[model samples]
Target: MADNDNRDHNRRDRDDRRRNADGGRPRSGGSGQRGYGADRGGNERRDWGSKERRGEGGDRRSYGDRDSRGGDRQDRRRDDRRSSGDRDNRRGDSRGDSRDNRGGRRPTGARYGQRGDDFTGGPRSGPVRQGFREERMDRRAAEPDLPEGLDLADLDPLVRQDLRVLSKDNAEAVGKHILMAAELVDDAPELALQHARAAKNRAGRVAVAREVNGITAYRAGEWKEALSELRAARRIGGGPGMLALMADCERGLGRPEKAIELSRSEEVAQLDREAAVEFAIVIAGARHDMGQHESAVLTVERMNPDRKDDSFSGLRLAYAYADALAQAGRTEEARDWFAHVVAKDEDEWTDAAERLEALD
Candidate 1:
């Protein structure tokens, strides 16, 4: 019995040693269980397995390296694309800025005055602008021989010639100088005309001074004198527009009959469309007032009605036609023309319908 117990104890001890070597937990010596070290090693193996899920070689270092490298490459690609986009945007902005600068930097006024500023060209600016320039450049009484009052060096090459003709000390020079300054004061037209007359004895004979005198006389309401000067200008180099303007001045002075005669004159036949319209409108109005209804209708019919699309004159005559028709007791026809004007939104012709309605 002693030998049997001893053999059983030896068997248990061997089994315990086997369990301890295998890294398992030993519950009891006789029960043949494992040690604490065996449990710890098993836990460490489980940690390694968890790490191997995301990394090679069973460690977190491998996963960290992969994630860090991938992030760096992606960030570099994004930075490169952003910088390229920024560069492209800058280039487009520069092109747009350059275009805008070019447009605004050009001198528009200088170009507009090109024809008038040219020495050989008749003059700078239209009639109104030229008149204004002459008024401003006229020498003052305080400075005699130098009438331009402006520094010659500062004057544009364009205006220099016109200024030169104005600097002489003759009678015309003084008269023109005073007249030009007087023009700045609209109320001094008569006084300036007197000054122009006085300068005549100084300069031998200046037609320009005579013209200035004539204009001043006209400004003072001397219609006969205006007609005289304008007629003399016409005898010289009067253009179509100039002739028409002279005719308008005569008409304004209560001489529409004389004005109408000039329009049919051989030399004034080349009047521009606008001047023709003006002449026709005045003639029509004149005939209407003089109780010449047939003549007024003929006057309107003479205008190029097709050009209505290009100018206001056609429409103007249309209203006049409607008025004449109503005056002649033609209500139905007049209403059609008046309605046509209304359809086109002509506020000026709206009264034509009311006139026709009065007839109705």
Candidate 2:
């Protein structure tokens, strides 16, 4: 009986040792002791098995023992890191190879007023620029002398004073050219135009320079140049004085519609008698251009050209009226006007006698 009791005590000691090795808790019916499964302070502690399955508890470094879902999370992190590295490498490549941002290169190709590198035709050096400037100076220095028999005494004092805006030498050059232009305008219109152009190159902003240039251009049959210079003159000196010439230039350009439009400005009403007559003649010409011959005759009739006025403009207006009347098939009235023009045209400036003879 003593040996039996000793054997039973040894068995109990071994059982207690096994329980202490597990968790130092008392054993239940079958399993040893439920670790972290008991309620403590109304909260059940998480089990070690569940934490190990999630790979988040005490065995955090045990990647080999991780479940399939944890393994997928690891793979996703690796892919994200690789993708971010690829994006950084692409940005570095763009910065390295884009020539526009490298080596002090401009992003927008060439700068303003600078020619591009592809042009291979011209010698675009500093010597070329200097040569152009020197050539221009030489041409200006060699401007032609004023013609002989040209009168400067009759030039308007105000017109001479206006030339003073230039340098002393330039003012003298421009003044002589202007005087020559005025003297030669009626006889040598092309030479007058050249002088006017020279004066304009020196003092273009002067109203009288622009006016002389316009008149010379008109007489030389340069309608566009005449209109441009006349417009400049009118802009500087606002008056009805240049409107007739501008309308005439428009007519010369075959823009009779524009001529008629300009002739109807409020300035026309305030023109002096001669200018009004000239403007009326341009309007009549514009009407004639549009195949409105009777309207042309009527336009000149409004001027009331008569024997009382023996002026050159009066004779020109009368001749214009007669020409329009003849164009409109009014023969008798045209014959009477031709006789009137023949009576007043003392210098025989018009061919009215031949026109009347043709009518007879």
Over the stretch 206-277, how does candidate 2's per-residue lDDT look in tens digits?
777888899999999999999999998866555665888899899999899999999778888878998899
Clashing pairs in 1: 25-34, 26-33, 26-34, 116-123, 116-124, 139-147, 171-202, 171-203
lDDT of 1 by residue, 274-338 (tens): 66776776677666666777787777778745424524666666777777666666678777777
Estimate the lDDT of model 1: 0.52
Worst 10 residues of 2 by lDDT: 61-70
Candidate 1 Cα misplacement greater than 4 A, ranges: 1-165, 168-222, 241-245, 248-256, 306-310, 323-360
Q: Report lDDT (CA) for all predictions.
A: 0.52, 0.74
Q: How far out, in Å, is residue 311 in model 2?
A: 2.4
Scored against the true structure, residue 231 in model 1 reaches a CA lDDT of 63
Per-model RMSD to reference: 37.7, 34.7
Evaluate residue 346 in candidate 2 and report its C-alpha lDDT on the 0 to 100 scale: 79
